[model samples]
Target: MAVTTAPDRAATPVRAPAHRVRRRPTAWIFAGPAAALFALFFAYPLGASLLQSFTAEDAGSTRWVGLDQYRRMIDDPVFLKSLVNTGAILIVQVPVMIGLALVLAVLLNQSWLRFRGTWRALYFLPAVTTLVAYAVVFQVLLKTDGGLVNQMLGGVGIGEIDWLNSPTWARISLILSLTWRWTGYNTVILLAGLQAIGKEQYEAAAIDGAGTLSTYARVILPQLRPIVLFCVITSTIGTLQLFDENYVLTKGGPDDATLTPVLYLYRIGFQQFDFGYAAAIAWVVVLLIAAVSALQYLAFGRERRR
Candidate 1:
């Protein structure tokens, strides 16, 4: 009887599992539109930019220059100045902002803090505020005459310091604006990192007779290293590509003291109409960012392994 049933096995149709059939098309259906849009927008533009970087284009002609643009970039005084300016800001601003953010995050994480929510919102307000609006407000507040900051200084029997005219002060003003706008964002991130740390570790440290400074140094800082690395890398990239605040507030003024890589790229592309050179500059910036990110990641990995 069993052998008889086997005779019909060749004609039997096997069916796919119901869940397999259902899931087969689910990913495509949900992700298809997003994939299409990303290809259309990001991929296409990035490819075009890469291609354009190698080709010199004029009003009526186009030709491949192979690295000529890059060579020119090396000799461009404006580009050099922009690089120096951006490097200065990156070296100074990132460390200061990260330290301040870490301090603020620690302070805010205390459970007994009063008006905690209000304080968090207040600190984060500048991040959400419109760039132009805040920049304008700062411009007005730091104005040479009758500005609020100067008025307050006068009332306090202090001389009204020049906020934007002098080169050093212009750089200071730019850094201050960037710190005010971005410090809260970094603090929020660090606060989240601080919260993710298990309370048991702190309890263990306390049981070991670790003081407040010892607990933070030995227990908390080690765990927070990855988050700190993330903040540093992102802040480095942002500082390297800085444009908006300098453009709106200082316009790279005081003899180009605040000129950044992105502003230089914008001037090359839009102002000078040298699309090929601009594309090359953009690629250089991208490569520099990638190298710095890789170095940071490698350093983190080495520390972790140790």
Candidate 2:
């Protein structure tokens, strides 16, 4: 009552500056490790690879070769063949997988479907299976003689088809293996996209007397466009860099019919010990992937604008 409140009012101190100082260090502490790791791992390797691409190592000496390796890539028949093979896979396998995934996703999205979880799990199992294990299984199953697939084909009056030794059949085998392993992964992604769509849109379509196909065409497909583009881009990149199945299943055999850009790069870098050429090949692949991804993004953007 003796003016105590008024006496303390002017003496109040500000702590905001000290509080900000404390927070700044805390923020740096949290972000520093991640930034450091990214620099050490991704940035350093990428830079080193880029540097290597412009230089050549010969007779234990390193010298700048500028675009020589890139020029050599253009003239190399094996590189061209690998590029064509990768493109063939990208063009054929990506669409087939995406279409199959969309169909499976839509089927599994039906709430009335029985054992939906189990079905999804079964479909997704192959995606999680070990790469080598699946490749070995496919190799055994697709063997030209006495294989399970050929035996079944023989029962149906179809002659034994060489899956691994012929160029065409080897490419088909690679495509089939890729589709089997990746379709379910894409299905899961598409299913997530489907689930994100609002139910009210479906209800509205139903009220408008829209059929299932019409509803999907008008509503679902439009909404899923972004996810579809994402899947396409990723699948294209994966196909461009295909190596594991080629290595384990066919070893890029039958005159390098199934050889991919990455497999070619591996042969150059490891098998032939041409690190600089491999680095150049790696950069070319990066450029191709970037170009394709950019085109897809632009197309999608144009459609969205329209």
Per-model TM-score on C-alpha atoms = 0.90, 0.92
lDDT of 1 by residue, 1-306 (tens): 455444676688889999999997998999999999999999999999998899998776989999898999889998899898888888888999999999999999998999999998888888899888888889999987999999999999999888888888988898899899899999999999999998899999999999989999989999999999999999988888888899988899888888888998998899988899999999999999999889989999899899
Residue-by-residue lDDT tens digits, candidate 2, 72-176: 998999999999998888889999999999999999999999999999999999999988899999999999999999999999999999999999999999999
Q: Once superposed on the true structure, which residue ranges of model 2 sit more than 4 Å away at CA?
A: 1-16
Of candidate 1, the 10-residue stretch with the lowest lDDT total is 1-10
TM-score winner among the candidates? 2
Q: Name the regions of candidate 1 deviating beyond 4 angstroms.
A: 1-26
Q: Give the TM-score of candidate 1.
A: 0.90
TM-score attained by model 2:
0.92
